[model samples]
Target: MVRREHEGSVLEAGQALRRGEVTSVELAERALAVADELGVYITRFPEHALASARRADREFAAGVDRGPLQGIPLGVKDLIAVAEAPTTAQSTVLDWGQGIDAAVTTRVKEAGGVIVGKTSTMEFGCGVPDRAKPFPIPRNPWDTERWAGGSSSGTASGIAAGMFFAGLGSDTAGSIRMPAAFCGVTGLMPTYGRVSGAGCVPLAHTLDRIGPLARTARDCAALLEVIAEVPFVAPEFTGDLTGLRVGVVREHHFPEDADPALAGVFDETLSLAEGLGATLIEVTLPYWKELTTAVLVTASCEALAHHRAELITRWPDFGVSARGIFAAGALVSGADYVQAQRVRQVVRQELARLFDDVDVIASPVASIGAPLLDDVADEAGQQNAEVFEKITTPYWNGVGNPVLAVPMGKTGDGLPLSLQLAGRLFDEATVLRAGDALQAAR
Candidate 1:
């Protein structure tokens, strides 16, 4: 039951399940035993998970296998519907979903992934924690008082704390990658529209992408393969970045107030990429500011469209952080939204041209590590959240490209630093392969 054996292990759980070294129920129990301590689960389905694991064990005994996720204990984000639990999306506003599974949930069950339970998320996937509400505040496993990046909060924290091997996380503007980065796990934000969003609470319909967060890139690929309905197996790649062209971007990600240790850790990662035989070249992302702006404006407006009535009728029911964001949508003009879309197209086209020169682009996922919990829940903290989206996640989300987040190194105080690898649209294979190569070098 050592977490290290499964942390970076790709289908090692599945392998053990098939070899009779362990039954699915044991893995489920191991995940369940440590679940409550990390503030990871919004709902715990102990009996249901054991039932699913028993079925998986029976299938394995019959010499039948679903895929990489078979017999693997996985978590579904609270925002996604599960027949075993209500869809909370970490809010008191809406909790009516029941008796049916979300599309991704059905996919997970079909692949024989044992659903441990629903993991926590921010309010409707757009807010930070609010103590005024009645939900659990997700704490980082590395340091409980430190923030475990938002919207997709508990899934990443749970993975880092060994609650579950991997899980589904939705990213509209960095929910998946941000938490993954802070928690020091690997999170994949697949190309938009690549995975269906049905039955999951919508944040920004056009921007929302359902993807996997796991301990490693290989594990993310395995989960994504089932949810995305595409083949993601890479061929014998490890510490071999030969002939790989990587664009190193530092234009916006390296902010002025960045942690002093950030430069050193990020530079070491680039050196490792070079040591592994990849060519690194300096490059600037086109329309970085405009695209980031588009993301904020688009997310707020779209989210507002969904929650405007509730924001009016049940004003205080929404979290303080969620209200501030959803209210901003009221300030945007129709022309402004149109302009954002136009700029999105421009960035997408320009990035497409940029991708022709480099096989993948790389950067530090954040200029600093996780902020302290109290600091992240205050007014200044909200501004920090804006800076976070602008610098790290929005640009890629705006352009509809697949991005992979991996632990690069640690800050002086031992917080995890993350590296992101972005690929061409629908070209997750390249990024996952590169991310795996980077992680293998560790």
Candidate 2:
């Protein structure tokens, strides 16, 4: 039995596999063991995973390596369909028979990645922690008592806990970045439409993006190389941010009541970026608050549209938190939806203008670290977690831009704080380059 801690980034694992240091079967078994212990998986397909691993091992032995993800064991959020596994979306309302491989799942499999199982998520990718639901709540690996952010909950917690090297997560209103921030892992939400959302459940058609969460920006780059629709060449890590222009949006992102520890860490990270020769300039986003409001309205209305029939017929089956959120969408007037779209267009144009002046926009991923499970167990906690603690993520979602959340430093309690880098549309390479530089510096 080879130890699992030896496993790290997908690149490192690929190198080790090529060197005969580890087998795909060993990695899959280790991942299953850890996932079972942590309750990170909503479903486990040990047999199917081992079968895939054995095939990956054969391919590697035959010198037919697919890529960095070849032989890597990865998790998929439950909302995404994987052949033969139930796409429960961590809700009782979904039809299990509708499960089919999502486009991203097909890509991962084609790249020789082993599908471990479906991971837990917030019900339909919206809602507070609901103990009433018949699914596991993903706890932050940093502190089991703290809640992992969702609806990419299990993917983030699983990666942070070393259950797998990387996993697919959908970001709409910070599902990927928030959990990645809370769990102390790196997550990327590519520009909307860069990756297909087909076969995966949708929260908001316009806001949803499929991307990877992993240990490092390079690993995410590797994953994106496989899954992205257009050709994406990852930038080389130059170990310094020379010639990079980073716009720091401190005024809007950092509220006056934000944690002093988080602010101090963010300031230190900015200094580090400056030391790397990157020019840092403070920039105020136009109508930042209104843009954020546009995200809420658009996402809520879209979600309501998707679940209207279900909410009408299966109200009891849905989690209370999800039901309330989706139901609130019904109250949104057509005029309000159209007005929100206008705001979105305006915000997008403003961001485009802002990006014309800077290579990337930087902000804190969240205002605070992960809150305790007990603190976010109900509606009040959900409000605190979604609205107060998280401010910057949804704004990017509204503008439909690529954002990468990378760990900057830890809180006084050892929880992770992250920095978000937003890039021009379809310019994920720049955001990732900045993230890679920061991670290397750390």
Candidate 3:
């Protein structure tokens, strides 16, 4: 029964705990065992997780509870600090030592959630997948050989494989959304400043955001209740999408580049939206190319500043991919960086204009479906790093809008296909509501 609960939402898990249908210790051990079996957690800290769960159980036993996440187990990104646990961030540069606790962890503890383990991550939250780090490459539970799509790779894979009900992941570009897409789960990048960033390792302070990835948007919403500064009104799960509007950009935005099955699923998703009374509208953003360029320049410069000391002191300790990318940041001129910021202002203004006409915009989470682990390895030393940047996330990060990646279905080979929906500024509730409707259709 506990194992069955693993595939359900964090809300369901909490219900089981409250009903005494499952013990925290039993659930913690089950999660830890699955983490080991699925290769979801690179660092299995069962002792820490069990102890935390036990504490939570005692609190509940005494009529002290912290809300929805009480006694729930979660895996946090290695980049986020866990007190007395090694914060490796999947970097060869990090020595094996305990790290001080981060603000997010502190909040979770206070909320009565158990930190099960530190999931794997790309060094310092860069998107490239290079095995130069000490930890094993995190595997996609849906298909072990495929890439899990980012710096939050392990967190997505871990949750999808039923290792944890939900987990914390950061987005500097699409770190959170991409992995959520590739892993067949739902993830959210809440409005900027909606959650605190204290204690988590910096990626690009301006662009980085921490959010939750879970099996469903409801689950993600439950986690958001903990991290968000203000109490969130969980969307009235009116699966009815009456009078809802969905905009699709097909040419350059969502092209034939998507895997066939993914394309099909997206089309099917459109039908579902229509059936629920949504009017699908076709739309395009102006100056899309500039949006992409501005994101790169801004993100690179911000990242360079954050890691200046580390890059200089322990340059060789970084994962090869991270080091290579950070080196490019150093080369960017002050003029180019400023120009990028100006471009960002333009992009944001344009996004604001678009949202005025539509409820939400939908697109593929990635141009291509999940790549094989071997493919990521094969391209490690490849030149034209900018090419990789263009092919992946950054634009949304630059614009600072809420992007929700909801698992639509799977590809021909069984890899997941996700549709990304970007909402107006600070409109996470509408995005989650849209996702909730889509998930129910599935």
Candidate 4:
């Protein structure tokens, strides 16, 4: 069985600490021991993390409480800056000159969350691993030969492998959800701009978002409470879905080339949700093809605007895969980017009408499990077209809504299958509530 992050979750660890069953130092030590095992972290902060853990112990002993994430070991995706470490972004082009912590990183520290290290990600959170580069190419915990999905590669796999309680990840097009699905963990992609993006490196400025990845949706909720700088209230996971109108969207989630097991596993998950009193209504997304294309067009153009200078001066400094994407942005016409923006507005209105009938939309995060590392990329860092098609996460990013990906079942090969819950604009509370209940039912 795939051991999930929930086995050593934040809630449980907090409870253990309160009961004097474990110390923060012990937790920090345990987190450090395995940090290097899965090639998860790009940078490690041993002395600093240990000192924070000791302070946590002092605070706890003196009856002081920070928040839900207090004393919890957490990972930060390397694309986000940390004053104590370099923000490598898994590439060689950028220089970290006197790194300052990102806004989100500051919030996490304020909540007493221990920063174990900076985890690995796709180059600038955009492409497949470029093995020719000196950075570590993340390997899956489920099957080492298979890849840990990206561009939030190491964060999700590290959570699944229990390297740390949970971590922060960014999503432009399925970076968070795709990796969570492949690695058998829970990842939340909050509505764009829900969390501050002051210091994190951008992939597509128009499409980028930051969110949490953990073993369960409730854990994600707790993390969100801290990171989003929102009001605090732990989401209830009563496994009760009464009066929950779930929009069942199977339009393109189940593809012709999907794994044979996807249909069965997805059906079983829906049945379980229905059993919990969720009224399922069939629905289809509007302009799925147009929106998908829009995302590509918009992302490429925006990314090109950011990297055009460096790309011209030092093309070889970038990974082969990232180079191609940045260069493609140059080919996108101004009209194309504007048209994609127009499409975003129309989809937002259409989804509003759709949301009037359903509380949340449900679908498969992906149709297949993680592909082998050999298939992740070639010498030029090009991924297989068919492999990329399996991910169903980009649509939500384009629509700019809060979505959650949670493990529903396993494939025939024991790789995880995942379910997605998408909610109305800025309605992350409802999305997390539904995700927690569905995960609890499963």
Candidate 1 colliding pairs = none
* True-structure lDDT of candidate 1: 0.86
Which segments of candidate 3 are over 4 A away from where they belong?
Answer: 1-5, 35-39, 95-99, 377-392
RMSD of each: 1.9, 2.2, 2.6, 1.6
Worst 10 residues of 4 by lDDT: 1-10
- For residue 301, what is the lDDT in candidate 1? 93
Candidate 1, position 197, lDDT: 90
Regions of candidate 1 where Cα sits further than 4 Å from its true position: 1-10, 229-238, 380-391
The C-alpha local distance difference test score for the whole of candidate 2 amounts to 0.86
lDDT of 3: 0.79
What digit string (tens of lDDT, one per residue) describes model 2 on residues 43-80?
A: 88899899999999999888897988888999999888
Cα deviation of 229, candidate 3, in Å: 2.3
Instruction: Give the range of the ten consecutive residues with the poorest summed lDDT in model 3.
Output: 382-391
| Order of the predicted models by lDDT, top scorer first | 4, 2, 1, 3
The candidate scoring highest on TM-score is 4
Residue-level lDDT of model 3, residues 289-378, one tens digit each, is 787877777777888887788889988777777777677788899999988888888889988888888888888787666777766643
Better of 3 and 4 by TM-score: 4
lDDT per residue for candidate 4 within 19-128, as digits (tens), equals 89999899889888874666788888889899989999899999999977888888889888888977878889885723598889989988888989889898988878
Looking at model 3, the pairs that clash are none
